[model samples]
Target: MAAVDAAADLLLTAARLPDRDGLVDIAVVGDRIASNGPASVAARGAIDLGGRLVTPGLVESHIHLDKALLSDRVSTTAGTLEEAIRVTAQAKRSFTVDDVRGRARRVLDMAVRNGTTAVRSHVEVDPGVGLTGLEALLPVREEYAPALDLQLCAFAQEGIIRAPGTEGLLRRALQMGADLIGGCPYTDSDPIGHIRTVFALATAFGVDADFHVDFSDEPLHMHVREIADQTVRLGWQGRVVVGHVTELAAIPPFEQDTVVAELAAAGVAVVCLPATDLYLMGRGDDINIRRGLAPIRRLLAAGVPVALASNNIRNPFTPVGTADLALLTFLVAVAAHMGSPADLRALVDTITVHPARMLRLPDYGLVPGCRADLVVWECARAEDIPATLPARTLVLKRGRVTVEAEHRVVERWR
Candidate 1:
């Protein structure tokens, strides 16, 4: 371990339950949490959280940095997924390493300010330009590792296994120190085949798999059955993740329950990107509207591990968003109809422990010896977060203040 400046540390104090009561103090040493309780620990500095809600630093399980940082470029007027893809494809050529790095850094700052301490951003690695994008973002990942845990998904936006030379690209990305493999299978021509091949390669390479299961509103686009069968056959039940199975919203209630059970038994986690889905799915004509969100309620009821994600940033599907996992939680609670107190706690896991599980994070929560990544929201109550979505007053990444709460003190001019 590298030596840290002992003089540049802090002691945070409050008086309440760390999760809800809005009064909890956390102590930070260097890059990990030292203590979190009612103790007046001596330190170089102390921050008074003043009865605000203390929470684990946010974690964005799904995000597209390549798509998100492209906000400043040309805009997509059609507001459809296909059009957005086309626009992004046209703009990819102009994105140099410097340009991508700069924009991604800016977006990271936004996320940091918004209390997101960990992010799993999907950087496109397909279409030849993906490697270039990854090269630019790798340093950013390392730069923030001490303060924030940043995981890059060597994402093949196209079909992974079916796309030409996809395996080679995946191999190259892993060689470049990428942490995981990503894919968009259901959208591909051979969804099942693509998923199987991707999963196979992931297992062989000893990497984690996070793939898009289905993004469409159509009932036929779902892949839960195929994924279950594949997991059992390949013996990769606990190692795979499928995001955005929005077709669950269309399936009958009984069918939804059955599928949820199957997914749980398969040991697969379902990631629901509520904000992105709210922007993309279920568009219709006169007097008929469809909700394109995944069946988060039923999935949770069946005890399937479900995580919430911020899938896109300033892309066609979701043109405006910071990597605030809390925002995803807020929107998901409303869309999924999970409003009870118990349900809210479960939903909070979507942004905290659930995503940590998917990312295979070694340690999480405010436990002893865990990394000191914590956040203090300005709100007085935890459940009130969904309605107000309060600003994060303080953000500590690995026991360091990556973002300090702003103060607006008024001094008398007398």
Candidate 2:
């Protein structure tokens, strides 16, 4: 064990780390974890966690903040992806800066209260809405910096080639302090051209690229192959992410292996949005509806980085959400048939380790010398988090207490 500090800014004692037995003391000096061992150290303040599970804060890799919380205003008869896009586009014409900021603040509050410390939100950038979403969300990033790290992605929800002036608008957004760029190839008239254009902007700006690709019940459009090839060609390895490749589930196992291999080799990461995929897909099927999810197990087994995200909250795309990542883990456990002890624990990583790596967050983890961003769960075991959605007891960002809650229950007729 490393030598303990004489004094710490804050000391978390008797904390149970995930995947490890017994308890240890974590000493935080300033904004970083100074030590993590059986330390007999002094501190200005301390909390005894009572052997509760302690893990790194959750990460939300792919979500739409501008389009969220619209289910109440807009009604959808057909839950297809096309209709969701059409209705959302129509509604965007009436959005105001205050309205977008207000809605985004609500979701961000929910995420932080649920133990999320980092988020990558895709804000629309196109001819219709222009940069209103980006403008609205830019201030929220700073407002929540004390409790959350928000990455604003300038997203081309409409097809870049078909939407006319969208490419220029995306460029302007990046200049306006957007962290990264995102593309939706399935909406484009020319999917390949859309991929090339997004990559062009990414390379020009020296920013990462995220795409919403292959979101369908059938294997009609598998543009991820072109994305993987371009990722390698542009030397953007480990800097590209693709979300909602539900079509991978429809292809044969052998064929899926080929594409998964390409993605892994190119260092491309995948984000699976179980809420939106399950809601929008299989709308045309009458019997034995498909799950309409990416090959999560296959991708994970192939050494590919995979994350499960909420994608939308109470919007036309998903129709319902609370911005709780743990609920998504529970959904994946049953939907993906990942019910084993190890698989359940791995699901926790989708929201923590995998997404943090996807976002390339520096100094993120539970080790010494990492950022002191931690979450103490009400549950004692890591696997119990997915099996039973436990409440968070404490959430710390940069060694400072951000959110604190207590969970209690009483049996009336015991």
Q: Give the C-alpha lDDT of model 1.
A: 0.75
Please give the distance, in angstroms, between residue 302's alpha carbon in candidate 2 and its true position after superposition: 0.5
lDDT of 2 by residue, 1-414 (tens): 474646899989999888678889899999899988898889999999988888999999998989889988999898889999999999999999999999999999999999999999999999999999999999999999999899999999999999999999999999999999999999999999999999999999999999999998888999999999999999999999999999998999999999999999999999999998888888989999888999899999998999999999998899889999999999999999999999999899999999999999999999988999999998888899999999998999999999999767898999
Q: Which residue pairs show collisions in model 1?
A: 16-23, 22-51, 31-398, 32-372, 33-372, 314-319
CA lDDT of every candidate: 0.75, 0.94
| Candidate 1 deviant stretches above 4 angstroms | 1-9, 18-25, 407-414
Report the lDDT tens digits of candidate 1 across residue range 1-414: 122334326767773443544444566677666666654556788877677776777777887776565666667766666777677777887778888888788778888888888888888887657588789999999887756788888887766655687768877888898888887876577777787777777777888788887777777777777887777777877777888898877878888888888889888888998877777776542255566888887877777778888787776778778777777767877777788877777877788777887777766777546777777887666666665777777888777777876757688895
User: So what's the TM-score on candidate 2?
Assistant: 0.99
Worst 10 residues of 2 by lDDT: 1-10
- In order of appearance, the predictions have TM-scores of 0.90, 0.99
Q: Return model 1's CA RMSD, one decimal.
A: 4.0
